[model samples]
Target: MDSPICLIENLNGTLSVNEQAIDYLMGLEQKIVVVAIVGLYRTGKSYLMNKLARSKTGFALGGTIQSKTKGIWMWRVDHPAKADRAIILLDTEGLGDVEKGDSKSDAWIFALSILLSSTLIYNSRGTIDNDAVEKLQPNRYVTELTELIKVKASSGASSADDEEGSGSQFVQFFPNFVWVVRDFTLQLELNGKDIDADQYLENSLKLKKGFGKNISDYNMTRDCIRNFFPTRKCFVFPFPATVEKMQLLDTLEDKQLSKKFSSTADTFCRFIYENSPVKTILGGKTLTGRMLGHLINTYVATINSGNVPCLENAILAMAELENQAALEDAFVMYKKEMEVVKALFPVDSSHLSENHLKSQTRSTHAFMERSLKDTDGKYSAILAGKIKEYANNLFEENQDASEKKCKALLDKLSATMDHGVKEGTYSTPGGYELYCDHHDTLMARYRAEPNKGVKAEEVLEQFLKEKSAESSSILQADIKLTENEKHIQAEKNKTSQMAQEKAALDERH
Candidate 1:
């Protein structure tokens, strides 16, 4: 998109999906790496998203204390480091807006970001000190995720127990955690030893050795962050410019910004592009843009309906929609390919079978590519049945075509003999011998005809049986034929009939 669009809108404490944005996402065929940013109001989240989109201005960056971005805005761009992939950057509305006066709504927004993103960035300012960490607890963000999201649709554990144990399950489904501390001026040192950004984050998250209420509250947010998002990263950005110029940060060119900030921003973009994984669900089923679109609707609807969003339910819903689509796609491909062979009607049985097998293989591959969570092979079985039905229909049509063509050829070859029979030309003393000669010659011409298909021998056998009575009557009426000679001719006719029937049977088998 040229600019970001509102994917989900929060209006008066209620969230609704934007169909326009969902439609755009549905059109993308590539796998996506979703990165969502969330933090307190006025925290420079949109700026980072704009940079990741490779645009100086995309997501709105406000210069005021009021939250500018409401709900979630989305910008989709081609992935820089991965082939056939896209990067979807989500810039959520700033959390903790006083005017909003809705902490529950903010929590839901936070939960949605976690559910949708492959990399979730908790954008904060100043430092990763105790005060800053506490802001991520309670009415802030991370601590509310458990209340806002559920791992399973229905659990046997009580609500209190479920919440306690659900944090461990969040690690399996949560995004890679990234903490971006803007305007950070503290030195990266612990115990007088300089440390890297990751080590600094780990140090800040380290729990204290105590068990009182005060100590437990102090460790709560840190423990949640560590336990819920096992894979974590940190980036600390120096102040971009003076306070006066910071208001105009969005309009400033890269050269105009602080050199250190610019360099770190570039590195951050590179890291995100290279390291963020393709979005996936349970069973490691990769999600495409279409699947992601379905997910957005499912999660948002669940939230709007006053129910905690469940990852298992969402995946099940997505699987049903995707599996049905996959089945249709596979069946369509099979039909398209088989139609090409159908045009060449009356094909040899072996030729038709060979093409059917090839088409079936291609169709199954197509189905497998798009299908997910088909553990019971339900969709696969459906596709197989449809393909088998189509193959049977095609074979029937081929047989019918062969029968029509062979019968037409036989009729054309017997035209002269039919006219002679009607004229009574075989009533003379030696006419039976002449009749036999003509009949043999006609059979030879029919056998020499090419492309008669699988039904060639069967049709010819039927025609010969129909003419047997006529041939017998003609042989008995011949005045020139002696009893022994007549007997020999009858035996010869019987042998030829048996041979023709056997040939037809063998062809069919």
Candidate 2:
């Protein structure tokens, strides 16, 4: 899209999906690499998102303390590194906004970001110290995640048991975690030894030994980050411009920004473009933008109903919707391909059968490309049955077409012969020889005609049988023929009729 749109709107603590955004997502067929950013209000989250999108004007970047982006805003851009994939940039409403006065809503937003993204960027200003860690502690966002999302639908077990099991599985579904410390001024060193940004982040997340309320609180957030995310990365950005120019950061040219800041931004974008994986479910079924749209609707509906969204239930629901779409797509492709062969009606049986097999194969491949979680192959079986039925109908139509065309050709060719027989033109003294010669010439002309279809011989046999009585009468009236020659002619006619009957039988088989 040229610009971003609000994907989810949060108004007075109520969240609703935006139909326009959902429709846009539904139209996309490429696999998505979703990267979502979340942090406190006015943390330059939107600015980073715009940079990632490779556009300065796509995501709204506000200079004031007030959060400019409300709810979740989505921008879709072509992936720089992967030709077959697209990148979806989500700029969530800032967390911990005092004006909102709704921590519950913030928690949901946080949870949704984690649920939807393939890469989660936790943007924060200043250093990664105890206060920053505390904001991410169990008392704030990390611990509440277990309460906000469920791995499965409820059983008869207790809530505590369910939470325990769900916590262990978070890493299986959670996105890769990235910590972005904006306007970082401190040296990257610990105990007089210089370290990289990643090592510095690791040192900051280190758990303090011993047990106490403070230590436990400190360790909880660190442990949650380590356990829930399969991978973690860190990036530190120096101040981009002077205070006077900071408010106009989005408007400034790249040359106006600090060299270090611009270089770091480039590095960060490169890392994201190169490393972020396509969104996938538990079975490693990659999610296209259309599937992601369904996922958003499923989660939001569950949240609106006051129930925690279950991963398993959402996947099942999405599978049903996507599988039906896949089936229709495959069937449409099959019909489209068959239409080309249908135009050439009355084709040879082997030719028609060969085209049918090829179309069926292409349709099956189309279905397999989009189908997911079809462990029982139920959809595949249904597609096969539908294609088979369509093939049978086409074969019957071919037979009907062949019959019509062959019958029309025979009627046109025999019109003159029928008129001559009715006028007694073949009943004279030497007329029997003339009649035999004319019939043989007509038979040769009929056999020489092209494109008579598979029932050619059968139709000819029927026409010959219908004329046998007329031929016998003509032979008896001929006065010039001897008795022995007439008997021989009768026997030859009988043999010819038998031979025609056998040929018609072979064609049918």
Measured by lDDT, the strongest candidate is 1
Tell me each candidate's RMSD, in Å, in order. 11.6, 11.2
Q: Where does candidate 2 stray beyond 4 Å?
A: 137-139, 154-166, 479-509
- Count clashing pairs, candidate 2: 0
lDDT of 1 by residue, 1-509 (tens): 88899999999899999999999998888999999998988999999999899988989989988889999999998887787899999999888899899888888888899999999999999999999898885484776667777787775443535754548777777899999999999899989999988999999999999889999888888988888999999999999998899999988988899999999999999999989999999778888889999999999999888887888999999899999999998999999999998898899999999999999999999999899889899999999999999899999999999999999999998888788888988876677898999999999999998878889999999999998998888888775455657788889999999999999999999
For all predicted structures, in order, the TM-scores are 0.88, 0.90
* Candidate 2, 441-487: lDDT as tens digits: 88888888887777788888898899898888888878545565788
Q: What is the RMSD, in Å, between candidate 2 and the native fold over all Cα?
A: 11.2
Instruction: Kindly give the stretch of ten consecutive residues in candidate 1 with the minimal lDDT sum.
Output: 155-164
The CA lDDT at 411 in model 2 is 85
Candidate 2 TM-score versus the reference: 0.90
Which pairs, if any, clash in model 2?
none
